[model samples]
Target: MTMTEARPATPLWRRPWMFPLGLLVAAFLAFSLPPYLGLDPARSRIPAPTGWYYPVLVAHIGFATVAMVTCALQIWPWLRQKHPTVHRRTGRVYVFAGAIPASVAGFAIALAAPFGPVGAVSNVFLAVLWFGCTVQGFRTARARRFGEHRRWMVRSFALCMSIISNRIWGVVWAIVLTPQLDTTFGGSEAALGQAIAGITTWTGWVLPLLVAEWWLGRSRGRRRAPSPA
Candidate 1:
């Protein structure tokens, strides 16, 4: 590419809809804490298996909220193009203040989730991926491998967005699609709901990551295409 070659156009991620969704999810996560603020198991979403789990959940939501909001900026192409320093600072916050503690608390909550073994295992996997991707992103950045850092950060954000996807799939599949698709999965509608929950628990994060990866590959391929002779 020549110096005169224009930089790539802004990607879909930087658009209004995408980053705003992250902010909305972050707000949702923040509001979620109030119900459990008094450590009232009754008001809590997962019912905190024990007294100890309550605080852990608060921490998880807090940090994951941070991750979601900050990670959004980390990927803005304009930030990369014009404000490398701000991007690095945001990346640090996303990893240190957000992803790491959230993973630990999230993993604990997943272990104690009343949903069942399938949901528990799925959450466990998500927590690990959440932590791993953030760390890898941080490491790559530290090593000056900015391109690799961006890829890993995208994966990290994809997992972070799973919070939104989980709710979406729950509403779509359990509330709408599943009933139309047979609704039984072998049992009653209640059973169908549980089945859909389990499926989305895994698919929520995994599917988004796969989609991001596909987009990244396609964009890279486009960038590498030969200029006309």
Candidate 2:
């Protein structure tokens, strides 16, 4: 092919893990959301304090789900590069209908989180970070600083996806620590469970954010590297 010839696009199947990861996310939501959709407080997976807690929790979940779905689309390279209009539209939905509401509701519920003090602090910090990154991303985009906008949005998306890691970490911790309850917590299962939950809550999001930062730094370095002659 001549220099002017357009290169053939890579097949979607050969693309990186995003598509398969997206499918896993979809599967998770499908399995996890049904119980909450019924809107009965009794069906809630988390223990609720009655009245306002359940309603706010439901609202948070709903909006976070919206953010989760749109963030995936927004970060999709094919859609962003080939269909800029769709990307922008979905970005608006992600900001207005998703991140804002979800983070606000998350902040509210985090104050009364049933998972104990460490989990509460983790949730609160996560909510604030999510909100801050999202708003900053929007601001950068508005200022036509596309590079900064992409970076900020990537951070926001990392926070959004951290919940999945949180669950995965929770399950792993539960499995490992359940057998140690008698020895470690004086036979108190509740104490052991709380300990695992708190530690995983921090590890879940913090670890993912650290990984995201490392990736961002690596990419930035690559961009700045001198091209081979």
Candidate 3:
């Protein structure tokens, strides 16, 4: 038998959770994308003040969707092991057509955020981290530093998926903090909403990145551990 034929199939038990997670991500895209697809500024979740804002916002969302979808394929071990060409192609798409453009637009959006400075700062940090991690990941891959490449890519992917976490945190924060509206936020719903938005936006990406770092550190520790004789 040829080498390819002799290779055993990857067991589904390995990282079984990823499949359902991908499905969830797909479901989110389905629910969230329809309104934005019509190019209607009125449908924007975030305010679109200037004429350029809506178009840029749309472009940012478009490229981010591409990155989110393609990164799933890129990080799938089964696909990478079985079809390296496809993995490489999709990785390129994630980096060039997705993350890069998305981050650039995200930076602009964050800078021009209609909300207060706290939310703007949080989003700007996210955009910068996403861009830096993605570019570093690509560079490491090019230099054949596979270990570092994997680490950086994992960080990039976590940042990419942070929007999902942002949504979850937003709901959680609203539920937990809404009651304190009068006492803590001077009874201003707008003030409370802005505070929650900033908190959620910061925690969304920051918490995920922290978790990713922990996982990466654990993996490295395991790799460095001495095996039994």
Task: List TM-scores for all candidates, in order.
Answer: 0.82, 0.93, 0.95
- Residue pairs that clash (backbone atoms under 3 angstroms), model 3: none
Question: Cα lDDT for residue 79, model 2?
Answer: 68
lDDT of 2 by residue, 1-229 (tens): 0011234534566668778769978987998799899899888998896569999999999999999999988887666766677888899899999999999999999889778888889989999999999999998888878888888898998999999999899999999999998898899977887788899989889998998899999999999999999
Tens-digit lDDT track for model 3 on 169-204? 999999999999999999998899889988989999
Number of the top-ranking candidate, with TM-score as the measure: 3
Candidates in order have lDDT scores of: 0.76, 0.86, 0.88
From the highest lDDT down, the ranking of the candidates is 3, 2, 1
Per-residue lDDT for 67-131 in model 1, tens only?
87787777676665566677677777888898898898899989887666888899999999889
How close is each model in CA RMSD to the real structure?
A: 4.5, 4.2, 3.2
RMSD in Å for candidate 2, one decimal? 4.2
lDDT of 1: 0.76
Model 1 scores a TM of 0.82
Worst 10 residues of 2 by lDDT: 1-10
Backbone clash tally (model 2): 0
Best by lDDT: 3
